[model samples]
Target: MSFGPFLLLALLEGTVMAAVLALTAVGLSLVFGVMRVVNVAHGEFFMLGAVGAWFITYYLPLPPGLAWLVALIIAPLVVGAIAALADVTILKRLKYDPEATIVATIGLLYILQQAALTFYGPDARPVEPPFSLRLQFPWFGYSGYKLFVVAAAGAILLAVWLFMTRTKAGLVMRATQVDMETARAFGINVDRVYAGTFALGAALAAAAAVLIVPIQQAHYLMGHDPLLLSFIVVIIGGLGSIRGTLIAALLIGLSDGVISMFFSPTLAKIIATLLVAMVLVFRPQGLFGARA
Candidate 1:
């Protein structure tokens, strides 16, 4: 078999997949970066976003593109608000005991999962892709929709990078990450920062879900894979490191996409997990984790 077209296709697919992973993983990294808390229920936020996008598209009686736009903006903000509320009400009190926070988040995860199942049913729901922007890449012979995913994700990531590196709020966030007490002493409102960070992180995940729903559809348990992958990306990228998470996500996305294209997705996933394990064994702090 000729390897030319297949290789090109795999590369394109890998790029697209990497974008999706980056969108989902960055939020996980951001939350850890700010609060030093690992949220197990992060995936549910993604599911909510997917569901939100689905409903907006299905019942809003609007054009698909407009509906998706509404979902992308509204879902993230809504989910982010919920997360912010959770942080203030529950997580803030448990800041001193991270283990307790972890357990609480796990419990929250179950609650969200069950709630989704109860409300949305156990079956996977289909999400129709928008028809307005069917960009055709004849050279690649692939769906224009895939390219749109790549472009949209890339734009979002770039925007996030700018927000983190360029804005005043971003600097405060970084400072808080380094030392919350010090940040507070310097007149930073630690509580507000924490709440904002959680909201921002959760919002990012919701954005990813909105972007993905047109392609992946909505389901109650759909958060499982993204949750696992987000954790892996955080671990591999060095927990709380945005740059590390982006790099790790790209690596994992490329490997998963290319390997799955050539072999079985199961094998691809196994290899991905093994790679992360190998990284952990050699560098427990993660590839870009801050050294003690």
Candidate 2:
């Protein structure tokens, strides 16, 4: 293959990475934007989704497509419910104190991780793709499922944007994000909003995990890299900015894919870290975040 085709392949791979990362980072950004709480366990929720997918498909006596469809719907809901429960039980009790919530979520992360390790076991497992067709490019063939991942993520993101921009629920969430006390004054249920937002964020992460698990194996420890990369994306794109998150995910994901293809994964990560540091030094508010 020529360099052009090779690069095109890299770009396609990067788009897949970007699609999943955008969903995960947007979830993180949304939680912080509305609740003003950093969810350290967000990644674990993602891991749980992957494990859930594995369990659902592994045990279900359905056709591969049907099983995948079922897992896709159930996994996110389960993880979201767990997240909502944690918010009510732990974060709410602490009054969502910034420092306290951080510590609490860190604890939650360990708890979920260990729980997964205990039950899900340590082996990495792969789920069969919902479809097996491959699209042939001039120089090579690519997984149709991977292309579907990109499309699915895009469709989900579009739905999210529409929900946030056009729905009453989105308005309430935005209002809460702007001023929790004022929104409460206006008759919004602040507690309920917080719980819902947390759940929504976890659901997004889980959804991303489900989309990517077919390509990447599900493992208890798989959350670590996504978590780290999400933080980087959120920081570079500007915390709480969905548009920024998308842009940053593309930049980081494409760079990582191309660099890893030509060089090393470690170098790609190092470059991303450095980019985050530079962004922090120059634009503390993030690329799209408003100055506070």
Candidate 3:
């Protein structure tokens, strides 16, 4: 491939990375925005989704496409249910105290990790793509599934946007986010909103995992990098701004891709970490976040 083609390849790969990162970070951002809860275990939920997908597609008698479709639906539901349970059992009990919930979620992270290690074992496994088709460009061939990932992610994001902007449920969540006491005064069921928000966040992460698992293998430790990267993205994009999340994901993703292609993955990550530090120091509210 020529320099132009290679650049094109990097852009495509970057788009894929951005898609996954946006999906994951949006969930993290949403949780923080609405519940004011930092879910340290969010990445573990993502890992669970990948593991669940593998098991589902592996055991189901359906064909690859059908099995993947099934996995896509089931894994997120399972993970979201688990998140909801966690919120009800752990977070609610603590009354969603920021410090307490942080500690609780950290504990949840280890528990989930240990559980996965015990049950799923220590092997990295991949779920096969729903379909395998390549796009033949004049320069080179590219993954059609990757392109599909971008499209799917865009669709999901659009749906989420619509839900938040248009639905009554979304209005309730937004109201809760703005003022918990006022929302409660209005009989909005604050606890229920928190639980639902947590579940929705986990569901988004799981869906993202299911989409990307075909490209990346599933392992108990697979959550670590995504966790870090998602945090970075959330921080840089602004704490609760969906639009900011999307923009930051694209910037970080494309930079990571181009930098990694030219330099090294470690360097790319280091750069991202530095960017996070800079954002925290200079603009803690983030690019899109409003000053509190």
Best by lDDT: 2
lDDT of 2 by residue, 1-292 (tens): 7899999999999999999999999999999989999898989999999999999999999998899999989999999999999999999999999999999999999999999999999999999998899898889999999989999999999999999999999999999999999999999999999999999999999999999999998999999998999999999889888898999999888988999998999988998889899999999899877886
Which runs of model 1 end up more than 4 angstroms from their true locations? 132-140, 289-292
Go through the candidates in order and give the C-alpha RMSD of each one to the true structure.
Answer: 1.8, 1.0, 1.0
- Find the 10 residues in a row with the least total lDDT in model 1: 131-140
Q: Write the per-residue lDDT of candidate 1 for residues 146-257, one digit (tens) a residue.
A: 7888888889999999998899999999999999999999999999999998888888898999888877879988988998888888899998888889898888888787
The positional error of residue 209 in candidate 2, measured at the CA in angstroms, is: 0.6
Q: Model 3 Cα displacement at 122 (Å)?
A: 0.5
Query: Candidate 3, after superposition: displacement of residue 198 in Å?
Result: 0.2
| Model 2 ranges off by over 4 Å | none
- The parts of candidate 3 lying over 4 Å away from their true place are none
- Residue 159, candidate 1: how far off, in angstroms? 1.6
- TM-score of candidate 2 on Cα atoms, chains taken together: 0.98
Cα shift from native, residue 44, model 3 (Å): 0.6
Per-residue lDDT for 291 in model 3? 83
Clashes of each: 0, 0, 0
Candidate 3 lDDT (Cα, 0 to 1): 0.93
